[model samples]
Target chain A: MAKPACKNLEEIFRTPHGAVYQCNRANCFWLEFAGGISAFKASDFLHLKKQVEQIDVPEMVQNTARMADIVILNPFRSERCFVLTVTDVLNLRELLQGAKVMLDLNSMLYDCLHAMAV
Target chain B: MKDLLRLRTSLTEEIETLLNEQIKVEAHSSSVYLAMSSWCNRNGFDNSADYFQKQSGEEREHMLKLFGFINDMGGRAISPEVTNIPQEFESFRAVFETALQQEIYVTQQFNRIADRCFKAKDFMSFQFIQWFLKEQIEEEYIARRALELFDVIGEEGTGRWEIDKQVPKIKYEN
Candidate 1:
């Protein structure tokens, strides 16, 4: 089976854990994580990113057994939670890093092009 | 790769949002003072009207100062849209009461901004806001003293008139 190649959707970021897609048409983000997919508003996505980044992984890793503790992301709109282990968090960090870079890139390009046009 | 967000705005997203909120608060305070000025003028409190008019201008100046700082720091400064200004007051005393309340609110907001800057480790903004923190002292003092006129003069019969006459003279020495 082939995954649908969303030619129109912009790939904001991708990682081994998952990928984030920005749908320009809807002005929303499509997050594929942990074998599940969900759509999020830009604000919600940023909030989720902030929450994830704030997780105290290094301290938790040092204090607890790796397999026992988990990070839970309970999306406001959904009943389901995306549970994450320490390793999963590191993967999420990578995904977020990539997305952040792309966002920064897009912003710079827009600024540069606008400056040149002006 | 260039960090566009950081490069274009030294402010963190949270800090920028908070600063913009402060801008709106300042604009609202300015509009509120102008409305108070109008109310005073209508109620025959001519000197008090002048006092409020001056206060409104000062608030506007503060807003513009913050606006200029944000832009100078590479953050996009929003021209705030202010609404919900009161056009009338219960009395002349009430006008001073409201004015005191507004000054206190402004002081609290600056304190909040200072705290945010400290938490974000944005010492530059913290240092910049130090002037505002100091200015609030004078602002609160004048507002408090002006309100005190109602108490000291006793708003009975021509008492409000006397208080109104002295409004312009109510200056914060410190």
Candidate 2:
């Protein structure tokens, strides 16, 4: 039921050029890149994040001699391969970590609810 | 300030992820059993084929049960992408050995999920997984018994044929 670019999505991670939102209706994560958006399943979303995190930005930055070697994050969508720099990698990692924390917090509350129930 | 995340579903992200993982495990088990069944059929073990086929069906049932529970609880139930199911096994006895190993793996996974549920204080999910824990007992028992046939009957001459005949009749009473 969640169409792309709709306010219905819950923002999980946000950056300057992009943000990742969870759409419970579709049970998928929507990655908002630029003015456009694309959807990825939960596993795929995690996979993408892992791939991004595995990129050694500092190493790349130094190896490329201060010029960004363009870390591209493609999410099954042809157009939205996220182009990144060393700084952008750090920001993306921060956003993903924040989102993961929120997700864990939500899960923790749900788990606690059962214990509180008589 | 608004709890938009929980607005759509009561299932939390951790529990959902665990359930999806279990689904994939069940699907993988099903595929492995089906492959075993086919291998048995090819090897002229008729009774063994039937037993493996039944096991495959039961594994698929387990997958569906978890899938239904996730959807019923307003969580997303992912249709797992199963991979790396080995088509060729070493020998006849090796199949049951592999089966026992798989069941033990499944029990271990369920235990991990239950531990997470208890740690999170999610008794509902913990209670839900109890059925699977019990079922694993029967699964492991049958698999062990089936492997014992290879030892008891001894695969010398007609021993394997006799073992194949007994495979379909092996049952757990309680």
Q: Give the interface RMSD of each candidate.
A: 7.6, 6.1
Q: What is candidate 2's lDDT per residue for B88-161, written digit by digit as tens?
A: 98999999999999999999999999999888667888899999999998998899999999989999999989
Q: Tens digits of per-residue lDDT for model 1 on A1-118?
A: 1233666577777877788887766667778777877777655666677778888987767776755578788977655587988888888878876887787678768768879999
Scored by Cα lDDT, where does model 1 land? 0.81
Query: Model 1: per-residue lDDT, tens digit, B21-111?
Result: 9999989999999999899898888988888898899999999999999888877688998888889888888888988998899899999
Can you tell me which runs of candidate 1 are displaced by over 4 Å? A1-12, A15-118
* Interface RMSD of candidate number 2: 6.1
Docking class of 2: incorrect
lDDT, residue A10, candidate 2: 80
Residue pairs clashing, model 2: none
Per-prediction CA RMSD (Å): 10.3, 6.2
- Candidate 2 local lDDT, A27-115, one digit each (tens): 77776654667787665666576677788876786785545576777766434677787777787777676776776676667657756
Badly placed stretches (over 4 Å) of model 2 are A1-86, A99-118
Per-residue error (Å), model 1, residue B56: 0.7
TM-score of chain B of each: 0.96, 0.96
- Model 2 root mean square deviation, Cα atoms: 6.2
